[model samples]
Target: MSARHAASPGRRDEGRAQPAGGGDGEYTTYYGRPVVKAPPWEVDIPAYMFAGGLAAGSSLLAAGGDLTGRPALRRAGRLTAAGALGFSMVALIHDLGRPERFLNMLRTMKLTSPMSVGTWILSLYGGPAGLAAASEVARWAGLRRGPFRLLAALDRPAGVAAGLTAPPVAAYTAVLLADTATPSWHESYRELPFVFCGSAAAAAGGAAMILAPADQAGPARRLAVGGAVAEVAAEQRMERSMGLTAEPLHHGKAGKLMTAAKYLTAGGAALSLLAGRSRVAAVTAGAALLAGSACTRLGIFEAGIASAEDPKYTVVPQRERLRRGQPVRYEG
Candidate 1:
């Protein structure tokens, strides 16, 4: 009897579990396939994408707030940055196999690991951004006297630091995914940065619209439109570049989500263009853009996970490398 038959509850007379390639050759679940080894990439990558977008958006919001003389946006931007920094730290630590060694990340600064670079960026940016945001809070609380005045003095410099790091925060997550073993991520690197940039801008615009009065949100509406155009263009370029491999973006749940996001983003952008002229339009478009940004992030995450789940993506590329007599490096 086969091992499988022997282990079966009532099949004593059946045969041993035949090897996979036996006459009944078919792929079977590995070792009865308990669902333990779910893809690690999905969890970490999504968190990274969200956190990065939040950071970039917060930075832009702070800068925009300063330019437009909107204290509420400045405060919102700071708080958002602080929250994103905290969440990112949690996600990174959680994703580590040895969560205790999370502190080891600070031991050496390596340029090669995008994770390391990201860690530094978060660490460097978080402090000043938080401080700047806190200053706004202090002023509101009537605590901007004595030593608190030093914090107020530092606010401008901190805001500048946050703004400068914003674009890099948006772009670095793409590098993080690109450096991984996933075929879709690696292939889409060029466009991923632009995609992230758009998402960040949309997020910032949404926050501005929600927090600031309509007149003060005019610049944010413009930013959202610009971001949407860039995102659409980059996605198109990425789809074209991948040719057949880009099927994931056009089929399945990933495809559906991305399509919805595209429509929402385009609609939102169009509305935002005219939103500046009307408070109602601005609010509606801002809400839509926010929803669109969330969908895009979710779609990107799901597509990457799907790409990793299939053996074809992993095996075919390795086979090609072997056929070419090149060393095959396995990525997980």
Candidate 2:
């Protein structure tokens, strides 16, 4: 959304009731205004999304490691989960413009609202992840006496609780994005959750792989490979099924970011397959996967904003659907 994002005022140039938002020479709009206004989000929203997913995945990894007696993996996963969740909260609060706005959201529990559900999801996931991470810190600081002993003893339970809520934490943002009026994002309702989950898993695994011992990083490597595969597949299917709405994802700055995400994810997954013996390979693969996840989130966020700013994406797709005798409902 660079040059194309700017919509200068212009009069209707077509004789038809609605201008040809398609590839015709004529076009129409409310003085070149977008059919649907873009979501008033900035870089913070994408950062929030990426960090939330990473936290969820890391919490799950922590639970797995704790259950399986992998101390290094568990500690690393818990620490990363806690750190990522803190970052996610910061981004969310910054986007909301006031910390109290986020606090006010906790007052209501609207089942049908993604914003409500996502807020509750974050709140619920945070407690357990924080406790688990805190327990690890307590152990490291030799605070296993008095009340600190109780905290350290509850590590497994806290980790398991975090894991229980991880899937929703990883996926709710996709639901929230798709529920919006943005043409590209709304059309991608079906596959976005899978993409988000996959990205989260890859990021968490990659980070843990880089931090944990090579011997205990087997699960992280596997998770990274599996996640990269799922992400690539879901994204491909989503694009293929989106018809006209997929245009934004394949053109301009959004397209370039997505291309980079694809290469990084693929390369990371490939390297992870052979990383079991070499710590250096594991670290490199982990870095690629982390970068890929960031790119994927950023690309999708930019694409949605771009599509929302373009009347062509909004009008042409609905018109095409109507021409095909399909039901088309205006969301706004």
Candidate 3:
């Protein structure tokens, strides 16, 4: 046989593949080829994630305010939700690079496509949220004479309808990311949904606190605290589950962002509880919460990128699977 076709006596497979033993055993690669492809998503993707989550969480808060006789909180929550949804849509279209191509997403539905489902959710969510927010503005500006009054009467019902979709909106982005081949993201699928939900709640509540009167901001503060707790708890669980695979989350640009997010989110939650007496403190807390939420999404995105770019992450895991006689291909 020619040198190129020569095989080593130690190999057993057709190509005489080198054995990649499991449990701390050394592994090999085919040249320097990357086993998994990195996502092409840019900053706009994470920005859309944050904005969509905020919109969803705020819509739920607005519904709660409507039922609780908190007009200031209701108005603030609904307006924020509607405005965030608008901005999110713009960012998504901008990222797609063509408005017409973006519209093509609505042309067909695929049960297997998370993006398709998310697009439909956004389309359905926008109408009720926008109408509710507009009705709030008309009522606040003393336009309760004509159609404004008619619109205002639909506020509660519309807010309720929007609220019904909020939880999924705040959570589906996690599924979208986790469904990918990115190692860190896929591995954390168990906890990412809850983490996003908690972050969303905190962002919505913090924004409401900043805009609503102190007397009406009680629920917002409480939500912030509860969300912070859940976020921290879920993140901890996720990291623990990752084991050595989570190294990307603690040793690079992603690490720095995650650390900052943790501190800012925790500090903001603390300040929110004590912000009842000082407007400045409330604003500070709100700003921190918003920043922290942004950091969390960016950090997760960066970690996924880091994991995908590194070939070792892909090879080692699959080698381990092979040694254990597990299927090398992903089913879903």
Candidate 4:
């Protein structure tokens, strides 16, 4: 037998017979070879994630600003929240196969589908945030004196609404990814929420420092530090728990992106301590953290897609289960 033919199961010397097709024929399995295809959805999924993180973080920063009586930070936070929400809406709609049917997503609630839950959350949260942001702008334009008074009255209510939704906004994106067929994302579901929370916090903090006066940036800096620490801890725990499945974190482009994120997060947190005393340091560190968050988001999205593309991730575990006499359940 030729070297290629010798590698086939038909080449065994113990009463093995070649198939009728002969040596030149292509080998075929009972089922077709596995094919990996990207989801038909646009790349806007990651952008939506980024926007959601920004909105959540901005809301949290706004609350922090309110608690500390930092007007500048509060104003910046509110504006950021509005802008993020706007971008989120745009990205989500852009991702829809039938954009007009987007609203129908709210027709039912299925805990099994994170997208449904996220839709509801966004709907509820976006209303108040949008109102609050608009009111802030109106107030700035001195339109609070006329027919716009009702909108001004909505400011506090909107603020309250945003505050309540902030944490979930950060967390639900993780659930969104987890509910998908991606193994890397689903396996890291427990850690993904915390990672997003940190990214949001860092991004919001950076935006606040960039916009607000130095004194008003203090609370944002603290939030950034807290978020960075939480994110690092969560990532470490995820890596430890996933074992060989977590190989994506240490390989190729994903590894480089994650590495950059970690360094930026850590360095930014360290710099935040002295940011209050140095405006330049505060702006520089905040920018770094924001960039880091973007890298982390992109890396996570890529990793999840990679995991879904590899047939081994889907098959090996099932074979192992079969070897142990366990009934395999096909999820997809």
Candidate 5:
């Protein structure tokens, strides 16, 4: 068939269905083939994403606690942050299959590679977080003398350094995901960072609120509320901005998770505000926020996978780009 003829549309009476991708009346793939391979990532990947963000945000909370002289909050935040980082590392290495392969990522640093940058951020974040947590343990164990004294003295500074890196550490995963061939992730890059950041904050805050004494947990509660607000707002804006690309987030398995996240987070935030001096209410809110944060990460990860598996998302967008005279670089 001639190129023009192939590109031309046939009558609906002829049983030819219209392309749903909104392309310029052209088929871009081989019989609607997927343009990119869906990620072979397992549940561990989103678990890593969630744990890393929680660690980063908790590190920041630890720093805040140190600066504000909230010993209980600092102790809780530092331990929680360090523990989460350890889990994040394990999850990442688990996803990489071989532990040695995870080490290979440290061989070189590349500004363009989000994975490289994220690896470095995690490493830098780990040192300070570990030190702070260790210092707290030593102090609690009555070993705060000589070398331990120095560690105790430097804990605040180390926490501050971790805090400095925490925001990017929490947010870099979004960039890592966006720098992929997945249509949903790439399309939502603008909002993903904010979404991750807010989720991280909420997770960390929730942890702190649960572990810290109520008197010292005020900041944690506030942070949870603020983070929940940011998360909800960013998600709503992202869906609106994504237009048709947002379908996966609102349908199927991914949709169910997101819907649950919305309700859980909103309820948690509301409860945090209403639970004045009520321990039960505070704990409930914390649990809800933590669950909501996990749901958000899983939902987003699944949505990306769904988008990649669906050929319409890949072919239609590229076909439209071709019609617009834009360069189409296929992902290998």
Candidate 6:
């Protein structure tokens, strides 16, 4: 037999393959082949994720502002949510290669499929968000007496509707990622939803703080602080709990981004306390929070890709699981 096809007596014992070739038992994959493929998503998918979460958070801010007599914040939140949702849809469609593919996904919903659930959540959140945003534009144009009257009248109700749907929109993407085989994302499933939701709230609050009059941004400041705390704490816990699967998140380009996100988020939250008294502080806090939220998405996305690129990350985890007698079934 040729060298590549040659078989050795030492290759097996008792009908079981021996340790891989000549390497240490630490490596599990044959010839460095990854056991699991990385997700095919591009930059567009992460952008879609970030935008969708921002939209959901903005909707919540809008609802809070409307009910509390903060007109500037209400307008800012409504406009931001609608704009972010639009960007999110565009990114998703671009990634899918056509708008029709998205429309087709709505034909039927599958409770067991994360994609199905996410599609419906986006659809349900889109309409009300759009109308609420249009109301801001109508008010800006002073069009209450025109055909825009209907949209204007429905503003508060539509804002409330969008708020109701916001939590699902912010969280479903994490579920979708976790349902995949990517080691980092899959391992961090328990904490990913909280991270995303908190990141969303922080982004939305930052945007409102930047646009709304500083004096009217008390709720935005509170949201920013609360969200930043939750996001940072969740990420810390996730990294600690994921063990081996989290190495990529702590020692690469992804690691730097995650570190920056933590500092910016925490710093922004602290600054927001003083935002109520200083416009400069409010703008700085808002910018920091938005950057932090974006970094979180990028960091997580990069970590999943990095983990998938290395066969050892995939193989080692499964081997350890098997060695420990843990259940190891992955759907895909």
Instruction: State each model's CA lDDT, in order.
Output: 0.71, 0.88, 0.83, 0.75, 0.83, 0.87
User: What is the TM-score of candidate 3?
Assistant: 0.89
Better of 1 and 2 by TM-score: 2
TM-score winner between candidates 3 and 4: 3
Candidate 4 lDDT, 98-161, residue by residue in tens: 6676789888887777788888888888888888788878878889676689998877778778
Listed in order, each prediction's TM-score against the native is 0.80, 0.93, 0.89, 0.85, 0.90, 0.91
Off by over 4 Å in 6: 1-28, 330-332
lDDT for predicted candidate 6 compared with the true structure? 0.87
Ranking of candidates on TM-score, top first:
2, 6, 5, 3, 4, 1
Indicate the residue-level lDDT of 72 in model 1: 69
- What digit string (tens of lDDT, one per residue) describes model 1 on residues 263-311? 9899988888777677788778878887787778778777766666543
- Residue 300 of model 4 has an lDDT of 83
Model 5: per-residue lDDT, tens digit, 235-255? 889888776678899889999
In the predicted model 4, the residue pairs found to clash are none
Where is the poorest 10-residue window by lDDT in model 6? Answer: 1-10
Q: How far is candidate 3 from the true structure (C-alpha RMSD, Å)?
A: 4.4
Model 1 is weakest, by summed lDDT over 10 consecutive residues, at 1-10
Instruction: Please list the residue runs of candidate 4 whose C-alpha ends up more than 4 Å from where it truly belongs after superposition.
Output: 1-38, 319-328
**Which candidate ranks first by TM-score, i.e. highest?**
2
* RMSD vs true structure, all candidates: 6.8, 3.8, 4.4, 6.4, 4.4, 4.0
Error (Å) of candidate 4 at residue 214 is 1.6
Q: Residue 315, candidate 4: how far off, in angstroms?
A: 2.8
In order, how many clashes per candidate?
7, 0, 0, 0, 0, 0
**lDDT by residue (tens digit), candidate 3, 1-332:** 12112222334344322435423343333453344678888999999999999999899889999899988888889999998998888888888999887679899988898999888888788888888988888887989887777897897889999989889899999999998888889889999999999999989888988999889999999988888889889999999986656879997999999999999899999999887998998989988998899899999999999887664565456557789999765321
Residue 57 lDDT in candidate 3: 86
Assess candidate 5 and give its TM-score to the true structure: 0.90
